[model samples]
Target: MVGGYVRKSKAKGSSNVSYSVTCATCDEVNILSHREVGGLTLPLLHSSHLYRVHDVHRTSITATLLSHMFSQSQGRAVKQQLRFYSSANMSVNLEGNIFVTGTNRGIGLELVKQLAEKTGKEAHIYACCREPEGTSAEALRGLATQYPGKITIIRLDMSDEDSILTAVQAVSEQIQTAGLNLLINNAAINKPDSLAQLSATGKKDMMEVYETNVAGPFLLAKLFHTLLQTAAEGHTSEGDKMSCRRAAIINISTIISSIEKCPETFAQAKMYPYRTSKAALNMLTRCQAEDFKIQNILVTAIHPGWVRTDMGGEQAPLITQDSVHGMLNVISSLSNKDSGMLLDWQGEKIPW
Candidate 1:
């Protein structure tokens, strides 16, 4: 008795009875004696046996039972679809409105490119860069053309507050009520300087680096706080109890920022200005993670490895695609538990 309504009858001097159930999906009638049903009631046995024996979508069965049990409950119609695939070939799709900074070249540009390739058609990507006419910008524009409406190039000079505000306004107009699901604080600058150079410059290089690396993300997060909150709110409105949707902020930090792991041999050639600013960025990430917990926003710091870009130089050990790909996988798998952590491209935790 697996799919239909159950009726009970008492038998004289015997505790056993017979019941019949009709499968909802296959409409097959099954008759079972009380002894065969074991300890389970008729309805429970029917539901469990039908699910185990049939290939019906699990969600469909749950929805049907809920609807039948609460016919007057006015539940919304549910649609169920199932897809089966091998674990070896699984691919994750990143959905929602995404905004990435420093996208004219290097890691930021690569992130935009790969996101376009991996996400669904409904995904909207806003690629931000300071110079729109540069060679790297031209390449990003080509990607925009290739992807049609999925990619948009915006001007964002992270060092300038006016430019940041303007870019935020533009993104706000585009996203409107949908809000931004992801914000990547990837724009940064690095000027190689030693202790000797710092003595002559009197904090000028440090100030410049801090402005773009630390202050930029701080201002950007402050300005976009509402939009991120809006995205989190929208996730709750979906009415799906199992939904893991959330808004996230990713800070592109570096492994060189690690104070504990800095090589003793390279102390003289240390880029102090760059390293200190990134360390400060990591601290900011921790603060944001704590403050944004109530809003359900995930904040994290990631080191993109030594990628061979304009900043990383030609001799760098890692390539742009590999670094970006690994970081994307890390970002896709992040949960609230991973917030405030300093992780490398491989998703391994790095010591502060």
Candidate 2:
């Protein structure tokens, strides 16, 4: 027998009472409202009947029920699955910092993982991607579970100005709690083409790439400059008059952008768009670094080495983790004395 207890609902001026029925099976209780039982009665009569759903809610419910069916008791359980996930690429954790960007599958994704795993320092990695539900982001969710309170995922497409603005607003809200320290510009892309092919595509793709890779980082830095400065000003170090070390901006760049070290192979390969965009980025890094000099913000461009991510491709020499580790070594070794200098992964200054 399906033994149960029914709780009658209390409503004013209503005789059609609402009741919740609790059924015990093997000493485990399952609760359902009378209305719910009524709906199920038809399914019991027609064994072929199946409930259908239209969207994510249905999918989540199905997955949740399947999980619960295997459990010993009909107890309510909060799903351990992550709704969102992210990683802030970091090598070593000097302090708890906030990192944000899109397209985490390549360099961006690797950076976030290394930051959390290698640094042994607390990090709040805000990793945004074009599709939060995409398979590429699933590994990130796993990372979030591995390190609770360490990562967050959001939808961010740098090409979309509104999304960029929204990401900044969210970061502003988070900084109130954890306090942001380093803002790393790690997300970048290149439209594969020669100068001849680029000319055919005209100014459109060029501007789009620049908007995402160059302008977006500049705007993000500008919006958070005050917050970063404030956070930095709160901490103090030995041999420092100020209460805190100034916040730092690490602008991820490419060696192809270096005018002094431009490889002949790159030009022959026709990677003009990628190279020029980063060159512009390097200049912007210089400008911002100088602008915030008095405010105690250290900004510099860094060549992370040729890494073997999607952008770097299989032929690229350096591993993503190795490149990031080298870069972190440079960052950790930096003194106020080294501010504003363009550096390579090895910590040597790159000629502007």
Which candidate number maximizes TM-score? 1
- Worst lDDT run of 10 residues, candidate 1, spans 45-54
Backbone clashes (count) for model 1: 4
Q: Tell me how candidate 2 scores on lDDT.
A: 0.61
Tell me which residue pairs clash in candidate 2: 88-112, 89-111, 89-112, 90-115, 92-119, 93-119, 235-243, 235-244, 236-243
lDDT to native, each model: 0.72, 0.61
Structural similarity to truth (TM-score) of each candidate? 0.70, 0.68
The parts of candidate 1 lying over 4 Å away from their true place are: 1-91, 192-201, 237-245, 263-269
Candidate 1 accuracy as TM-score: 0.70
lDDT, candidate 1, 1-352, per-residue tens:
1234433344678776654444445655455565543323222201221111112222121112222432322223222222111122234446789999999889998898888987887788999999877776998998899999999999999999999999999999989989878999999987643333554544778889899999999999999999988888888864321112358899999877877767631353367788889999999999998998788888999998766688766544456766777788888888878888899877889887
Q: Write candidate 2's Cα lDDT for 178-252 as tens digits.
A: 456777887777775434464555566678779888988887888778777776666645323221123778888
lDDT value for candidate 1?
A: 0.72
